[model samples]
Target: MTIQFYLNGELRREDAVSPTTTVLDYLRVSAGKTGTKEGCAEGDCGACTIVVVRKNGDDEPLYEAVNSCLLILPQLDGANVVTVEGLARDGHFDPVQTAMVESDGTQCGFCTPGFIMALFALRQGNEKITDGTIHDALAGNLCRCTGYRPIVQAAHQACQDATKDLYGELSPLIPGEGYEHNHQKFFAPQNLSQLAEMRTDYPKAMILAGGTDLGLLFSKDRDPLEAIIYTSSVAELGEIEETKDYLEIGAAVTYTRILPYFERLYPSFATLITRIGSRQIRNVGTIGGNIGTASPIGDTLPCLIALDAMLTLYSKTGSRELPLEDFFIEYRKTDLKPGEFIKSIRIPKLKNKQKFRAYKISKRYDQDISSVIGAYRIEIDGLRVKDIRIAFGGMAEIPKRAVACEGAILDKEWVEDTALKAGLAVTTDFKPLSDHRASKDYRLCVAANLFIRLYRDLTDAEDLMEVVAA
Candidate 1:
């Protein structure tokens, strides 16, 4: 079978390239589109950013900026891709490129292509242009020279004027085609039943969603797989359903698609989501992928656990529902049975008098792994704590709840003294490992101090927590 996609307004049908070939390598080696550079093969750096155009259910075009290094050839099968080379027409540059040149945003020109593509996505988007928006859009792109002043200037000028949708009139391309090359098979299922059948057949195949993490095997480690089951194409897995009781999110739903819901329902969670990665990463990454990784420091795990989320696991025979916390068994492992895949996550809405707050502590503000993340869902009655749930990451083997810490604050008055007592219980909850991001003592100290911070945040004591000049 052949992998078909539109590369720079031209259709590309290929059966020769390996199924594991990354879009970065394909662009540079096979297609000879060297304009998209590769700085870090991993998704951290934005040097290999590319714009992917796909149609939503309403047939409206959504242009997303994603890391090409982490994208496999089959992942772009039915989308329209635009690299830096595609930004010119009739001897004229795109507005973003022109703004970059006018503002002198280029320094050594190595990271220029990535920045231009990232800013190009910003210009095409309908978001209100502001300093914060520009900063959030370019957070993934790094510039060693020619500081951000000129870049910010260019963003203000270029993104202020809205651009017309170029791919709006085009019909949506049908994707979900199985591809095989170099003895490797890739199954892109169109529905959940097909996904279950593929999973039952190729049980050992690596299940790929956004490929934000698994793509590292191909792009960075050069690991070859016998088969892969792509879940992003399954129509059932890309849905977001909201009910009066809860919000159900499909496993294949991307972060960009859920950010709006989060912003409205969980504002603090939304703030933490923005800090997960740049727009490029969020445009493709998914919460289900984060939960599937089962990492101790997965950003969304603690928040979801604190919120009492439930997971629906699917198999060829049937399906079952399990609590989110019970799914994680050990380090880098889960309770998923053979041939079972995550179907969707059901998160109950916050009831009256209950508020949710999440805090992520990392070295750098953006694009950095967490040292310790604390998430809390608390319900208060007068001055007493009615009920509370606290979950922490980077403090144990899996994203686990602080059971001991929660007990300390339960049935107690919501005051500074009670908060301090809970902080002491955190030391006994878990003994974290010392890593490059933070030390064991630092993690413990921070994890405990977060209780006080949360108390200050909920009690409207922000003035007292502020530091005074010596």
Candidate 2:
């Protein structure tokens, strides 16, 4: 079987290629298109950034920046992909490239392609051009030599005119059919029944949604996944529905796509989601994938657990719904049965008198994993605490609620003394292990402090997200 896609408006059919081959390798070795550089095969460094242009429901083309290093050859099946090489036309530099040249954006020249591609996506978007937006777009692309002043100037230069290009100018093309090569199979199922049947057939097959985490297996760990059932192609799993009760986010919905609704409905939670990854990561990372991985330090887990979210698991046998909290059985383990995969997550919308806030303490400000992610949702009546839910990631073997601490503060008056007691009660929760991220003591200490921050953030108008200027 062959994988089909459009590269620079030209149709590409790839056969006899290894299923586990990263797009970075395919671009450099097989295709001889080396414009997309590979600095960190782990997708941290955006040196391998590329643009994927596809059609949305409205028949309008959407161009998104993705890390080629983290992309498997099969993920591009039936999609349109553009690398740095595709940006030029008739020997003329794209606006982004022209701007970069004028502003001296390239110094070492290795990471320039990635920066240009990232900026290209920004230029094509209908966003307000600001330093913050530009910075967020380029956060994943790191250039040590250039202080980023020139690159930002280049972004400004490119956006001075509305970006019009060959990219997204044509109608979107449909994705390719499934393929199998050398005992490895890549399945792209369009409907839930097809997905469920595929899972039933390939019990141990890897379920890949956004490939943010699963892509690391092949990129970094070199795991040649024998069979992969990609959920991103499943229309049902990719749907996002809003109801009177909850926000039903399909398992395949990327963080970038769901962010706008989150921003409108859950601002604090949206802020935390922004911190989950850089714009590049979020472009392909899904919240359902986050829940499926069941990682203890998952950025969204703390928020989901605190929100009292529910997971809908689908299998060939049937479908079941369970509390997100109950989904985690232990470290890196979930209650999901064989042939079962996460279908969707339903998060209840905040209502009148309900307040929610999430705090993340990390070693760095941007694109770094959390040392501790604390999410809190509380309901208050006057000075009395009516109801509260608290959850933390990176403070235990699983993203868990501080049940004892919640008990300590429940129905208590919102005060410093009350917060102190609840903070101290955090010890009753799981004992976090010491690792490179933080020490056990540090985790516990921050866990206690977050409750205080959450209280202050909820009671007063003081922004916990703000950094005090010097």
Candidate 3:
């Protein structure tokens, strides 16, 4: 089969490129689109930023800035891709390029293309062009020379008058076929039944969603696979539904797609997700992958486990439900049966009387791993605690509930003094190890202090626990 996509406005149909070839290498070698530079082979560096124009459910084009180095060729199978070379007409620059040059935004010129493309997407978006928005838009694109004042100024200048985007009127390309090379198959099933059959047929196949972490195997570690199944193509696995009790999120839903829901329902949880990675990372990372990875410090797992979320697994034979807290058996181990795959996650809505909060303590503010993440759900009946659930990451072998701490907080007065007792009770829980992010003692101190922080924020006038500005 052939892998087809619109590259820089022209149609590209390739039958020879391997499934493992990243968009960065493809652009430099095969397509000859070198304008998109490769700064960091990993997704962290925005040096290889590119815009992908794909159709949403309503068939409207949505543009997103993605790291080309981590983006595989198959990911753009049926989409419109715009590189820096696509933004010019005869020698004139796009609005972003024009604004940059006019506003003195370029200095070293090494990271210009990535910044241009990133800002280009910002100009096309409806977000207000301010210092905060501009900083977020260009967070992935780093430049050591120009500083950010001029870039922010250029972004503000360029986005002053919104105009038609380059791909505004263009029709979106549809992914209608799968590809195979070197006898390796990539099954892109369009429906749920096909995905189930494919999963059963190839139980050992590597399941890919967004490819944020999965691509690291090939992009950075040089680990190649034999067979793979792409979950992004399965439409049903991307649908989000809200029922009377639970919010069903498809396993393939990206963080960007789910952040708004979290912000509206659980603001603290949404705040922690924004700290997961930069805009480029969140655009492709999925919550299902976080649970599937089963890392002890996964930013979302502690909150999800504390919220009593459930997972819906599917197989060719049938489907089953498992609690999120029980899914993780141990370090790097999950209770996944053979031929079983996660289809969706059901998160119960927070009750009116329930108070939910999540805290993440990391070394740096952004793009950093958490040393300790605490998620709490407390219910109070006037002065007495009705119920309390506390889960922690980076504080145990798994994303687990603080059973001892919860017991101490249960049936007690919801006051600072009771919080102090609960803090001391967490000493009976698992002993956290010392690491680069924090020491064993530091982790425990932070973990214990978070309980007190939660109490103070709930009882005090200020909401110091709420995360803002990113």
| Highest lDDT model number | 1
RMSD of each: 2.1, 2.9, 3.4
Q: How many clashes in each candidate?
A: 0, 2, 0
Candidate 2 residue lDDT tens string, 313-379: 9988899999999999999999999989999999998878888888889998888999998888888
Deviation in angstroms for 301 in model 3? 0.5
RMSD of 1: 2.1
Off by over 4 Å in 3: 144-146, 168-172, 462-470
Question: Candidate 2 — which pairs collide?
Answer: 78-175, 78-176
Model 1 bad stretches (over 4 Å): 165-171, 461-470
**What is each predicted model's overall lDDT from 0 to 1?**
0.90, 0.87, 0.85
Task: Give the TM-score of each candidate.
Answer: 0.97, 0.96, 0.95
lDDT of 3 by residue, 1-470 (tens): 88888877788898898888888989988888888887778887688899887665576666789888887888888878898899987787788889999999986646888888899888877677788888888878877655888888899888997885666344456785477889777778888889888888888889888887887877787665777888888988898998778798999999988988999889999989888877888888888888889999999999998999999998888999999999999898999888888899999998988889999999877777899999999898898999888999999889999999999899998877788888897789869988778888998898999988898768745433342211
Clashing pairs in 1: none
**CA lDDT of 417 in candidate 2?**
74
| Clash pairs, model 3 backbone | none
Instruction: State candidate 2's TM-score.
Output: 0.96
